[model samples]
Target: MHILILPSWYPNHANDIKGVFFRDQAQALAHYGHTIGVIALQRRSLRTLFPKKQNNKAPHFELDEGVPTYRCQVLEALPKIPYGNYFLYKRAAKTLLANYVEENGWPDLIHAHSTLFAGAVASEWGNENNIPVVITEHNSGFALNIYRPWQLKVADKATQGAQACIAVSPSLGEVLDQRLPSSKGRWEWIPNVVAERFNAPASKKYSAGPTRFLNLALMTEKKGQYDLLYGFSKLIGGGTKAELWLAGDGPIRAALQELANQLEVSSQVRFLGQVAPNQVPSLLQQVDAMVVSSHYETFGVVAAEALMAGLPVIATRCGGPECIVAEGDGLLVPPRDPQSLASAMDHIAKNLSEYSPHAIAERSKSRFSGAAVAAQLTYLYTRLLTSNSKVSQPKS
Candidate 1:
C-alpha cells in the first residue's frame, strides 16, 4: 500500500518543530510495510521573512525522515495578496500533484493531517480522480473556537468528500461532530504515535532542590500557560518546594513570562524555549512529572509522551487529555481554573513517591506507541481499500 500524507503542519528548515508528529506517524505507518510519502503546502507571506540562504529553492523535495516528502512552496515573496490564498495553494498543489504522479504514480490513499488547506486540497483532488481520501484532524484551533469561518468551510467540504474522518481523540471527534454533522457517522479514533525511546520507565531522581514539573507546549493562550503559572504560584504560596519548566516557544512566551513575573512565580519558573523533539525523552526523564494545561487539544501528544517517560501528567479537562490521561497515570483538572490546577500541582509535589514510573510506562504501550497506532491505521486503510474495491467493481 502506498500513502500520500498532506499534513497542514509539517516540519521544515524554517520551522523544524512544525508537525514533527505527522512525520513520526508516517514513519510508524511505514513500519507496517506500507510505502508512505508525504507532501505539505507551505505558503510564505509578508508576515514571515524567509531566510536569505533558501531564497532560491522552490518545490523543495527531500526524504523527510527516510520518507519521500515534497514541500511545495505556494505564493511567496508577494505583497498583500488579500485573498483566500487556498485558491493559489490549490493551484500549486494541483501542479505539484501532476509532477508527483509522473514520478511515483497515484498513491493508494491520500491522508490529510488536520482539515485546513491540506484536507481541502486532498478532497478536491480525490473528487477529480475518483480516489479515496481520509482526513485525520489534529488541530485544536477548531475546538478552541479560534478558527476562521473559511477554515471550517474548507474542512466541511473535505469531510463531505472523505471516505472517512479520523480524530486523534474521542473528545476531538465530538467537537468535529458538533461542527460538521455530516462526518459524525464516518468519524474514527486513532491516537498519535509516540516513539519507543520514551517508553523506558523514568528513574525518578530527586535533586537536592525544588521538584520539577515540565510543561511542553507552544506557550500560547489556548495552551493555558498563564493558568499553569498561577497554579504554580499557588503551590509556591503553599510552601511547596517545586518549580515549573515551561518548554516550547510561541507568540505568548513574552507575555507568559511577564505574567509569571507579576504573579511572583518568576523565581520558580524556568522558560526553556524550543526544545528539539529528540531531546524530549531526556527532559522527561529528568523531570518528576508533566503538566498539560491547554484549553483543548486534538490529542495531547506530550501527555502520551510523558506517560511513555514514566512521568505522571497533570492535564486539564481539555478535549484530548481526558482520553490520554487515565486514572493513576495522571490527574485531570478543569481547564482554565488556576485553583484546581494549583491544587493538583501541590498534591503531586507532596505525593511524588506514590506514582510508579515503570507501571506508567508499561501501561502506556498499547495506547500510544508508534507500532500500536500503525496497526490500527493499517486496519483502517485496509477497510478503505476494500471500500474502494466495492466502488470500483460492478454491483453484481
Candidate 2:
C-alpha cells in the first residue's frame, strides 16, 4: 500500500520536535513494507522576517530515512484576514500534492495528522479526487477548550469526511466523540509509537544516589511545573531523600525557577534545559523514576518512553496518562494536587522493589513500540482498503 502523510506541523529542521510523531509513524509504516511519503506545509510568521536566511518559497524534497518527504514553507502575512493562514496552507498543500503525484503517482491512501488544517486539506483533496483519507487527531484544543468557532467547524468537517478518525488515547477519543457526535461511529483509539532508541535493559537495582525523579516536558503553566515544585517540597519536608530533575525549556522556565527558589527547593532541583530526543533514553536510565505533572495531555508520550526504558512513572490522572500507566507500572494521582503528587512520589520511592522494571518494559513494548503500532495501523489500512473496494472505484 502507498500512504501519504499530511501533518499540520512538522520539523522544519533535523532537531525540530514539532509533529515528530507523525514522521515516526510514517517511518514505522514504511518499515512495515508500505510505500510512504510526507508532504508538510509550514507557515512562518512575519515576526521571523528579520532572521530570514534563505528563500523557502519553493518546495523542498528529501528522502528522510528512506521515506520521501516534501516540505513547503509560506509566510503568514495576512493574520487579520479571516481564514487567511488556512488559505495559504491549502494552496501550498494542493501544489505539493500535485508535485508528489506527478513524481510517484497517486497514493493508495492519505493519512493526515491533526484536524486544524492538515486534516481539512486532506479531506478536501480526497473528496475531490475520490481518494480514501484517515485522520488521526492529536490536538488538545478540544480538551483545553481553546478552539475558536471557525477552527471547530473545520475540525468537524474534516472528521466527518474522513474514512476513519483516530485519537491517541481513549480520553481523547471520548472528547472527540462528545465534540463531534456525527463522527462518533468512526472514532478509534490508537497510540503514538515510542521511538526505538528508548530501548534499555531493565535495572536490577536502583541507582546509588538520592532517588532521582525526572520530568520531561516544556516548562509551561499547563504542564503544572509549579505544582511539581510544591509537591517536591512536600516530599522533601516529609523526609524523603530525593532529587528532582526537570528536562526541557519553555516560556515559563524563569517563573518555575523563581517558584523553586521561593520554596527553597532550588538546591535539590536541577533544570537541564531542552534535552535532545536522542539523549532521552540515557536520561531515563540514569534516573530511578519519571514524573509527569501535566494538568492534561492528549497522550502522555514521556510516560510511555520511560516505561519502555524500564523506569517506573508517577503520572497524573491527566487525560492520557490514565491509559498509559498500568498497575505495577507506577501510581496515578489526581492532577494539580500537590499533596496527592507528593504522596505518590514518596510511595514509588519507598516501594521500588514492588515495581518490576523488566515487566514494565515488556508490557510497554507490547503496546507502544513501532512494530506493535505499525501492525495495528496496517490492519486498519487493510480493512479500510478492502471495504472501499466493495463500495466504489476512484474517479480518474
Candidate 3:
C-alpha cells in the first residue's frame, strides 16, 4: 500500500524536534513494507523575511532517511485578514499535492497529523480524489481549550470527513469525542513510537550519588515545573537526600530559578538547559527516576522514553501519564499537588531497588516500539481500505 502523510509542522532542519514523531511514524510504515511519502508545510511569520533565508516560494523534495519528503514554506502575508493564513496554506498544499501525485502516483491512503490545517487539507484533497483519509490528532489545544472559534470549525469539518480519527492518548480521545460529538465513534487512541536509540541497552552503569530525579520538559507554568520544585523542596525538608535535575529551556527559566532560590532549594536543583534529542537516552541511563508534573498533556512522550530506557517514572495523574504509568512501572500522583508529589518521590527513593529496569523496558517495547505501532497502523489501514472497496463496488 502507498501512504502519504501530511504533518501540520515538521523539522525545518535536522535537529528540529517539531513534529518529529510524524517523521518517525512515516519511516516505521515504510519499514513495514508500505511505500511512504511526506508533505510538510511550514507557515513562517513576516519577521522571517528580514533574515532573507532561502527561497520560500518553491517546494523542495528530498529523500529524508530513505523516506521521500517534500517541504514548502509559505509566508503569512495578511495576518490581520480573517482566515488569511489558512488560505495561503490551502494554496501551497494543493500545488505540493499536484507535484507529488505527478511523480509518485496517487496514494492508497492519506494520513494527516493534527486537525487544524493538515487534516483539513488532507480531507479536502482525499474527498476530491476518492481516497481514504486517516487523521491522527496530536494537538494539546483541544485539552487546553485554546483553539479559536474558526479553528474549531475547521477541526470539526476535518474530523467529520475523515474515514478514521486517532488521538495519541485515550484521555485526549475522550476530550475530542465530547468536544466534537459528531465524530465520537470514529476516534481511536494509539501511543507514539519511542526512538530505537532509547530501546538500546543501557551503555553506562549508574554511579552512586544522591538519588537523582529528572524532569525533562520546557520550563513553563502549564508544564508544572514550579510544582515539581515545591515537591522537591518538601522532600528535602523531610530529610530525603535527593537532587532534582530540570532539563529544557523556555521563557520561564529565570522565573523558575528565582522560585527555587526563594524556596531555599536552589543548590539541590540543577537546570540543564535544552538537552539535545540524541543525548536523552544516555541521560535517562544516568538518572534513577523520571518525573512529569504537567497539568495536562495530549500524550506525555518523555515518560514513554524514560520507560524505554529502563528508568521508573513518578508522573502526575495528568491526562496522558495516567495511561502510560502502569502498576509497578511507576507511581502516579495527583497533578499540582505538591504534597502528593513529594510523597510519591520519597516512596520511589526508598524502594528504588524494587523497580526492575529490564522488566520496565521490556514492557515499554511491547507497546511503544516502532514495530509494535507499525503493526497496529497497518491493520487499521487494511481494514479501512477493505471497507472502502466494498462501499465503492457497483451492484452485482
Candidate 4:
C-alpha cells in the first residue's frame, strides 16, 4: 500500500549522524514493498536576519537510500517558543505534500513517528484530506514539557482520531493511555529493531585488568550522562576496578566532561564522541557491559543492540529500558539515581560471568529482530487502509 511517513527527526545530508533510527524504519518499510513518502521536521531554521548562517547548515531536499523525504524548516532561534508547536510547520509541509499527492495519487494512510510533532502534522493532514492517520509514540512524555496551554488538548484530540496508535515499548503505551484517556484507538506494542551487523562477532578485544563499561547515548540532559559520571565515581570510590567509556555527542558534552574532571574520575571516563553506526558492534564487543541512564526513552536502541552483540546492559528502569532489559539479559536501576546505578554497576562487575553474551544476544533477538518489526508495521498499515476503505463505501 502507498504510505506517507512523517517523522519529527530524520537524517539529512548536512547531519547524517542524527535520526539514524528513523532512517532505518523508513528503509525497512520501503524494502517490504510499501510506497513510502516522508515529511521530516527540521527543528532549526535560520532567521531572516542571519541568512549567512543558513548557508553553513542548509537542509538538502532529496531521497536518501530510496526514501523520498521533504523537510519543513522550523524557526527555533526564539527561546520562548511554546512546545508542541507544529501547526506552522504542518501548514507549510501540508501545502507541499498535498500538491505532491494531488499530482501523484493520495497515499493509503499517513504513518507518523513521535506523538508531539509528527502526530500533530499527520492529524492535520489526514483531517484536511479525509485520510486516516497512525501515530507511533517514541517518547514517554518528557518532550511535552514545553507544550503550551492548548497543545495537550490538541494532542489528545489527534490521538483519538487516529486509526491506530503504536508505542515502541509498554512503558510508553502506559503513558499514552494515561495522558489521552479519551482516545479509545487500538494501541500496539512495536519496538525498534537492530540491524543484522549488530549480531556479528565482536571485532575488538578488552584487556583482562579492569572491567570496561560502555554508554551509547546522546550527551543530553535527558540521557543522564552526568548521573552516569556521578555513579561511576561512586563505584570507583568503592574499590571497583572498572573504567567507563561514553559514546555519542550532544550539547552537554563539554559540561559532562567537566563534571567528570571535577569528580576526579576523568581518567576512568573516556568520551568517544559519536562513533559510526557500523563501528558500534566492535565497541560493544570490547566492553564487559553497557550502561544506559537516560531519564526518558521511547526505546533504548543502544541497550538492545548491546544485548544483541552478546553483551549485558545495565539500564535505568525508565521508558523502554524497563521493557527491554529483562532479568536474564541485564540489570535495571531506578532513573536518575546514582546510588542505584552504582550498585548495579558493582553487581555486574562482581558477577560478570553469569550474564553470558550468547544468552543475552538470543534474548534480544526474540524481541527486536528487523523482520518482525517490518511485518508488524505492515499489518498496521494494511489494517488502517482496509478500515478506511470500508468507511468510505456507500451504505448498502
- The TM-scores of all predictions, comma-separated, are 0.91, 0.95, 0.94, 0.86
lDDT of 4 by residue, 1-396 (tens): 878888877765543656677777777778878888887767764446456554435343566678777765776554456642456666666776765576556777888887667787777668766778888877655334555556677677768767788888877777677667655445689888777678836343334878899998778898988889999999999999999999999999999999998999999989999888768877887789999998888788998888888888899987788878888887998999999999999998998878777777878877776766788888877777776763353211
lDDT of 2: 0.87
Kindly report which residue stretches of model 1 are placed more than 4 angstroms away from their true locations once superposed: 49-59, 76-83, 147-150, 201-208, 390-396
Selected candidate, larger TM-score, 1 vs 3 = 3
Superior candidate under lDDT, 2 versus 4: 2
**Per-residue accuracy of model 1 over 200-237 as CA lDDT, tens digit each:** 64455545568899999987788998888988888899
Give the per-residue lDDT digits (tens) of candidate 3, residues 27-75.
Answer: 8888889999999998789988777567434338889888889998888
Cα lDDT of candidate 3 equals 0.87
**TM-score, predicted candidate 2 vs. hidden true structure:** 0.95
Name the best candidate (by TM-score). 2
Runs off by more than 4 Å, candidate 4 = 14-17, 45-60, 76-85, 102-104, 140-145, 184-186, 202-207, 276-278, 390-396
Ranking by TM-score: 2, 3, 1, 4
Q: How many clashing pairs per prediction, in order?
A: 0, 0, 0, 0
The residue pairs in collision within model 2 are none
Question: Higher-lDDT candidate among 1 and 3?
Answer: 3
lDDT of 2 by residue, 277-310 (tens): 7778888888899999999999989999999998
